[model samples]
Target: MDVRLLAASAAFALVSSITPGPNNLMLASSGLAFGFRRTLPLLLGVQAGFQCLLLAVAAGLGVVFQRHAEVQWALKLVGAAYLLYLAHGLWRSSSTGSAAMDRPIGFFKAAAFQVLNPKAWMMCLSAVGAYTLAGAAYWPSVWRLVALFFVLGLPSITLWAVFGSAFRAAFQNPETARRVGRALAVVTGASCLLVLL
Candidate 1:
């Protein structure tokens, strides 16, 4: 890949990772509930899952998605359901003030979550489609783009976790934390609509 193309891939990766999305929002929510140290697994798991998705797309799985409308519909339904469930969980956690919320989502669970995250799918597909140069030589370009994304996405995503932890101080009061949690719930739940869009 040309140096310019590599730079563009890095820029796109950072922007996509930094933008407010289900994963970043959830990371922030988890950090607020469990603290940054505790939410680390979710952060790492998301990166791991993302890399796998990127690899799959590079290997041409995205074309299968392009051909199968029903598959996309089914995935959208499942993803929407999962997002709604998480929203409800966050809502209940806020209302109940239970320690259960302190248990951050596990590594495997977070990794599994990437498949259901429509944004993740779109990112992987778009990266492969847009960043990789066409022709038989595209494999090298795919690897380069994936590598750049992995390198750039880490700090981009970490900022959300750090920001959430910073909110810990601002939300020192139980009531304030509760309010933040409820607000997060609304954002998280609303992400479900992205499936339709």
Candidate 2:
């Protein structure tokens, strides 16, 4: 694998992991509700799930979607629907209560969501499409790319969770917390739309 391509993959992972998305929004909510320490499992689960997904994509399973138009559309449709669901949750959050929120999502659920998340899938697709070379060396390149992502990905995701933890301070007021939660949910939904469009 080329050094430049490796750098690009790292950069992409950093941006995708750190940016506002369903995962980060949930992390922020978890942080505000349960404290950063409690949310660690959730964060770790996300990283693990994404790494697995990347591995699958690298192994060519993700490429199968390219051959089947129906599968591609199904993924997009499901992804769009999930984002809308998240948006509704946000738009409906209460604005005037103590930062009362559900307990943080468990590791299993968070990991599973990664499989369904459009944003995650898109990131994997973009990485595979852009970085992996063609022809006889493709498999080797894919393996290197996956390894690189695992190395670069964990820290990048951790940073986003930390950012979410830091934002917990803004949730001191119940009403404020509720309002912020709703806004975050909306952003999550919007991100899904952005992927589709």
Candidate 3:
């Protein structure tokens, strides 16, 4: 890839990775409820799943979407439904006595979440479309795009969790924690509006 193009791609990856989208909102909520360490699986899942999605898009999933327009439409519907489901779950979150006993979106589940995450899909598709070079070096370019996202994404998303964890002390109170959970639910639910758009 050309130097200017690579730089532009990196910038896009950074902005998209760090922005307050569905993943970031959920990660922040998870961090507030479960703490940083407990939220690791969710983080890992997002990265792994998004990497796979980017690879698939790079390998011609975009073309498939072009050929079968209905497929994209169907995927969008499914994605929207999943977002609504997640929003409902967040809105109804109950206070857990123990972090260990509480299951906050596990590794495999989080990874699978990417399929339903419209933001994740958009990021992957945009990355592949904007970065991957045509010809022999295409795969390499895709890998680099993945690297750019991974390197930026892991840290970018982590910051949201860290920000949430900063309020861990305030959440020590049970009543306060419940309110926080409700607030997070609102935020998470609002993030799902993007899917509707």
What is the TM-score of each predicted model, taking all chains together?
0.93, 0.82, 0.88
Which segments of model 1 are wrong by more than 4 Å?
Answer: 99-102
Cα deviation at 72, candidate 3, in Å, is 2.6
Best by TM-score: 1
Pairs with steric clashes in candidate 1:
none
TM-score: which is higher, 2 or 3?
3
Ranking the candidates on lDDT from highest down gives: 1, 3, 2
Residues 26-114, candidate 2: write the lDDT tens digits. Answer: 77767766777888888888877877887788778787967887887787787678778756655565443533345677788788888
Measured by lDDT, the strongest candidate is 1
Give a tens-digit lDDT track for model 3, residues 26-142.
Answer: 788778777889889988998898888888777777678768867777777787776566656655653453331257788898888787777887888788877888889888888
Ranking according to TM-score, highest score first: 1, 3, 2
Q: Higher-lDDT candidate among 1 and 3?
A: 1
How many steric clashes between backbone atoms does each model show?
0, 6, 0
Q: Model 3 lDDT vs. the true structure? A: 0.78
Report lDDT (CA) for all predictions. Answer: 0.84, 0.73, 0.78
